[model samples]
Target: MDYWKSKVLPKMRLIFVKAGGKKAAAAAELVKSFDESKGEINSEFEEKKADLQPKVVEIYESVTAPVKVLIKERKKVSAIKKNSAAITKLFEDLANIEFPGAKQVSEGISKVGPALLSSPIFATFEKIAKLLPVVVEETPKEAPAATEEKKDEAAAAEEKKEEAADEEKKEEAVEDKKEEAPAAAEEAAPAATAAAEPAAEETSAAPAPEAEPEAAAPAEAESAPATAEETPKAA
Candidate 1:
């Protein structure tokens, strides 16, 4: 029983795992619904595309086709037209044209678009022409670079100013030290001389005081003998 439970239970658990989890069941339901919706939408889109594809492909093919090079190309420039409804009419008119040569067809389309659209067509074409190069490869302006250079120059000028200020402070400190040196030396010299004078006077008088003490003691002894003689005469 123990072996059966241990082995069979594990095998049953593995089977349950193979059946997948609750989250997986929910995800599968969601995917099934999404796939059905996607299939329906795709079929509808394909049917629509089937109707539009031929016309769009024709336009694409005509645009891609090579044109015969003219020996002397016409330097023809169209006048600017300013109209909104005219531009839409021009696109419609160009769509109807089927030209003999590819170059002629392209030229016909360009001319027809400008003529029908008028000013709006010209403005849109100009805008697209300006945008195409910018969209593909951006051209950076030099203003930021010029500003960065100015900032660097300003920083350098400020650093030079700070260095000059530091140099002036150092010069002032040096001058102050120089001015204090003479006063310090003069003040120290008087103190030293005054201390030396006292030492010299004490040394010179020290020997004189010791010699005078011996002379003074004999004078006191002679006076004592005279005083003894005067006492005997009085008795």
Candidate 2:
């Protein structure tokens, strides 16, 4: 960041201030755009930086420094162009992994030649940003199980077996409770029906008094027998 601000940024401002022809004017416009976009570029770079190898980033910085020096010193255009091409080559050679995105950056630099040397570090930063997410990427993978002592292995296996047994027992208990619910409901059904029938019978018989006459007749006969005994005694 310091290098971009101190070294490359000054050069870019100079390119803009010294803008003359059409191409220079366009390049000057590009420098301003690069300056404005640096915040986004830097934020993205920071987020994905952990995946990139530091060696590659240092090498890229090295490549950018010399090109900026050559352009600042007003060295030959051919020398600046050579160093610019080297930036693209450095990334391609340093790429130790296969990835589509990194390949694209290298191919793009090969075709474009890393913009004019006087421009801001826009192309350089962008190339690094694209490569950061892919070059030497560390894919997350499940670690291998560590070796264990025979005693520990046996104990772990026993614990796993115990857990399995406990789970099976819990399942059986749940099934038993489920079965008992229906069985209890069925047992209660007969008692409820039996009690209901008696209630219905009592309700139906409550309004009827047909047995009263029979009860009265038995009492009258007892009275008559007593009367007969008294009459005999009197005679």
- In terms of TM-score, the best-performing candidate is 1
Error of 2 at 32 (Å): 1.6
For residues 94-197, write the lDDT of model 1, one tens digit per residue.
33542112222233334343332222323223322222222344335777887899999999999999999999999999999999999999999999999999
lDDT of 2 by residue, 151-183 (tens): 679899999999999999999999999999999
Q: lDDT score of model 1?
A: 0.49
Model 2, residue 175: what's the lDDT? 100
Off by over 4 Å in 2: 1-20, 54-79, 88-119, 122-235
lDDT of model 1 at residue 91? 43
Candidate 2, residue 48: the lDDT equals: 56
Q: Which stretches of candidate 1 lie over 4 Å from their true place?
A: 1-140, 208-235
Alpha-carbon deviation at 30 in model 1, angstroms: 84
